[model samples]
Target: MELKGFSTKCIHGGEEGKYEFDVIPPIHLSSTYQLKYEDQDFVYSRVDNPTRRVLEDKMSVLEKGVASLAFSSGIAAISTVVLSFVKPGEEVILSEDIYGGTKTLFMEILSKRGIKYKYVDTRYADRLEDEISDDTRLVMIESPSNPMMRITDIEKVSKIAHEHGLKVAVDNTFASPYLQNPIELGADITIHSATKYLGGHSDIIAGTATFKTMEDYELVKLHRTRLGGVLSPFDSYLLLRSIKTLEVRMERHCKNAMEIAEYLSNHPKVEDVLYPFLKSFPQYDLARSQMRLGGGMISFKLYTDDQDKVDVFLNSLSIMKKAVSLGGVETLIEQPATMTHRALPDEEKKRLGITPGLIRLSVGIENVEDLISDLENALRNI
Candidate 1:
């Protein structure tokens, strides 16, 4: 049955009535299935697994993609996609304000293999055309980008990339499927770090890549099989369970985040707040046009340049835990300059707005007042 509602799709998208009595899908843990016929549905765990297949199917439904593949981690999914598609000597243009790990992967590891990359401010869609060389084969973008909350015009960028015979891949992890679907907006591939919102509880480290066509899916699936970065059956089952409540979870997350963003924007100590829905945000209109909500991630800069004050404020937080990684039931706060983006060079970090005073918050589903009070107290300490 075709599902129209997002919540309904989350709960029943990949269900095929394999069990008539049981309401929940069973987790198939067997590493290998006995080969009985010439062409059997069951296969080895690395190539395919029942549990992972269901999760992949559900992800495809949510992301509005023709097919989806689950991987061991977010990096694995991204690396596989890049390696599978972009050959040696072909350049991949990426957003300047991107995830540090992704930057390291492309520049450090992939570059050693003769893969070329360019960092551009994809937020300005028109400017992207100038950077597209004959060797440019792909464009990777992270909308509402990590820490900086930069929003790119996916449809515009995808249109520009496609015209130049380059495939567009969007890192939709920050927005999640509930907030955004890159494929629906014209991207060739949509990627998610399921370790975040999709898994919901930070218990699983998994990733997913959804494709607009079956051909691309097959191509990536082949690499995933050979590389053996497939998600485990247990983690796949956990992710499937987490996704069922995604809509409800995201609603609370967005509500809490909007209130926090507003509070931060008004604070005297906050130099800037970077939530997509915040009116003061530079790309508010474009973000609203693309995303369903502001999303749970927020990045703001402290007015003070004092490193001690910044450290004091982060340490002073009682409710919002000072930690890395986002999209959990509890709020997580971190300074990207010293935390997530520390590996990046000082010049590159400053260029991308990863300032020492900049703070990134992954708002949670907690009571809004409590969260605000926590922030207020933290700001007072600063």
Candidate 2:
């Protein structure tokens, strides 16, 4: 039975009802299964696990993909997926506003192995044709990109990439499957750091990669198994439990984020607010076309660039925690220049508008008024 509703899918999508008639899927912790036949579904935990399969199955359905793979971490998923498609000489074209950790992987790790990469503004997807080269193998983007809140047109970019016989992978972490599904928008691959909104409680560290085609799915699964980056059965069970409430959690998250974006936009201390749904956003139309909601991320610049004032504001915050990662039940605030994107060079940070005054907030499913009051109190200090 196919689940038609998003919330229904989250709760019951991958459930097979084969675990001794248990209403909920029980955790299968056996690292090795006793096999009596040559061809068996379960052999080793690294290759596959019942619990992890359920999570992957749910993710595939949620992302509207043919299949999905669970990884030990988000970076591991990115590494496996990229390596599966690209070789040492092949290149990957990336959005300039991607996550800092990704930049490190390409520049520090893959580059040393002869893999080349170039950054471009994917917001204008047609620009890809101008930069496309024979070496280009993959086009990677993050909608409502990390820290900067920039958006890329997935359908337009996917069209251009497909025309060039290239694979398009979208980091769908910021806008969870509830808000957006990259595969539905024509992307070949959709990736997520399930540690975020999928976990909803910041308790687990996991990632997922969903493929539009079974061929890509089988290929990536081979790499993931060889690399031994499979998610543990225990963690998989926890993530599966977390995903059941994803729909309800995201609803509150979006509601709080929209209200917070509006509040910050009107604040005098805030120089500017960057949220996809805001009319003032440079890519508002495109964002609306790609995403169902504004999402829970909001970035704003402070009127003053003084480090002292920034510290004062950060210290004054009572509710929002000053943290690094995002998409949790509790609001988190951070300066990307010093936290998430700090690995990039000074010039790159400057180019991306990650400044001392820039504040990135992952609005959680908290009381809207309380969150706004916390921001107000913090801004007053600044």
Candidate 3:
């Protein structure tokens, strides 16, 4: 059957059983599949599992890529893709504002191995070209960047990288395939922490990497196997089930986020709101041009620089839970400096606009008025 819709693809694409059997995809618990003479399909669970393959196939179709690989966690997926291209003494150009774990992987691990990285402000597309050099093999960026909500020009950056013979890797966790498809805009690889939006309920921890061509696919697949970062069959089943409702979940997430952002912008204790959909955002135009939706994440600053005020604001919230990760059915709020980006130097964090007063909000599929009231009450206490 020719699948024509996203939801349809999610529900039917990876499944093999018919109505006589269970409607849901059966979990292939067996670690090894029996093989005929000289033929092997699923020899072992670690190398290949039938259940995991379904999730990979679903992700490949969603991202419009040639192939997809599942990993134990988002960091594992990122490390696999980065290591596939990066070598000792080589360099990578990355955005100043990125996931804390990714930044740590580059600074703490890769740097120890003599692989260097330069953090650039990709908000200015012109600066990207100036930073590229013969040693720069990859350009990594996270659009609607973490904590800051700043967006990079994917098309511009991809074109510049190609001109310099550099490969482009985009972290599409914030703006999932529902909001943006990086490969369609010339990105060589699209990565996601499927633990967040793709898994929707915050029940599973998994990551995915989708490659644009067979060559790139083989490179990442080899790294995944050698590094032993494959996802479990059970986690794959959870992810597959969660992806079926991604479109609907994301729609509500975007709508609720926009409302919450507006409410925060008007609050007395709020200094600034950093949602791309809002007109007050610096990169509003770019966000509109590149993303299909504004997404559920919002980052805002408090008027007070005092740490006491920040504490009061966080403690006053009744509905929005204080949490580390995001993209769940319930709203989540976190302080990046202490939680996500705690490992980075103070100077580097400040350079990337991560401050003590900055708060990252992941608006959930709750009533808009209730979410706004929760924020307003928290601001009142502040």
Candidate 4:
């Protein structure tokens, strides 16, 4: 009852009914729940599902927020939250370096709908004020941001946004609840692509958005229902199972990543390594101050700018798979310029530091030595 540790919370939180009939939570596969009376707890899976409810509840507690909403995909969760807060002609301020899909949503979809966005370099918290406009309704950011591994000062940015009467949303997919809680850092909402870290093994696709206040929660929840971007009961069940081991898996992931980052930094063929823990990182102090751990992602630029060298490095890898997504049990390596951020124009990609020679590595729970050897061999070929 005391809830002494993270692992304990991971396995037991929001599992109130698991004690009664099932040791493991039952997968409520039914699309609609039978109602014995006019008013019932669950009526439709689209509006609510037992499995998804459990995941939402657990994530809310983990994120230290009032409530959480589940969605069909990460982008769905993002779009719902953005659309809920932002209106036509309203402006949203976001980091220049973010997930490709998110950038597409803001630049392409939201812009087409009359919503404008201001892209700023979030590395300097002071610069945010220059970009913030009267019409800015939301301030979105990704700390330890994707592909580049840049750390933003969430607390400072949240302070700035709150002073301007703007809502702050943070993409916590990179630094999951195990490492950082953005809600506690003064963010109004925390969003996650549960497909990455929360579903740890990379088997399920899901997304979650946690809100600090009940009002914001209901607003997002209503939009989620109306948009029909709801997570399936089966995927919810998978997420629940995966979250039970999140603490353990994240520990291994962080440990392995730090080790690998150090190795890559020392490598002759490596130009620079982007990781939160490295003292050389621009925001090293802030990362240490805000996060419990540096996290599992490592991005580095090769010494050679040759595209062929990059290909050789990726092909030479024996252990790490050349894949697109990250935060899985197995290590994954990919070039963001061509793989993840391929949709962006060349100038925009370069502006975000997603160069052709840049490689992003999602370190896994695999043997650190083996991962190191694999990267070393790959670098040797370069």
Q: Cα lDDT of all candidates, in order?
A: 0.93, 0.92, 0.90, 0.91
| Weakest lDDT window of 10 consecutive positions for candidate 4 | 16-25
The Cα error of candidate 1 at residue 281, in Å, is 0.9
Q: What are the candidates' C-alpha RMSDs? A: 0.9, 0.9, 1.5, 1.1
In candidate 1, stretches whose alpha carbon ends up further than 4 angstroms from where it belongs are: none
What TM-score does candidate 4 get on C-alpha atoms? Answer: 0.98
| Reference-based lDDT, residue 75, model 1 | 90
Best by lDDT: 1
Q: The CA-based lDDT of model 1 is what?
A: 0.93
Task: Let me know the TM-score candidate 2 reaches against the reference structure.
Answer: 0.99
- TM per prediction: 0.99, 0.99, 0.97, 0.98
143-167 per-residue lDDT for model 1 (tens digits): 9899889999999999999999889
In the predicted model 3, the residue pairs found to clash are none
lDDT of 2 by residue, 153-252 (tens): 9999999999999999999999999999999989999999999999889899999999999999999999999898899999999999999999999999
> What is the per-residue lDDT of model 3 for residues 1-382, given as tens digits with 9 covering 90 to 100?
6877877877777564432467776688887778775767678788888888888888888898988999999999999998999999899999888888999998889999989999999989899878997899999999989989889999999999999999999999999999999999999999999999998898888999998998999888888989999998889989988999999999999999998888889887788999999999988999999999899999999987688989899999999999999988889999998898899999988888788999999999999899888888888887
Distance (Å) between predicted and true CA of 158, model 3? 0.8
At residue 255, give the lDDT of candidate 2: 91
Residue range 1-382, candidate 4, lDDT tens digits: 6666888878888786644768877888888877898878699989988888888988987998999999999999999999999999899998889788999998789899999998888889899888888899999999889988888899999999899999999999999999999999999999999999999897988899999999999999999989999999899989999999999999999999999889889988899999999989878999999999999999999997789989998999989999998889889999998899999998998777788999999999999999998987888777
Of 2 and 3, the candidate ahead on lDDT is 2
How far residue 89's Cα lies from its native spot in candidate 1, in Å, is 1.1
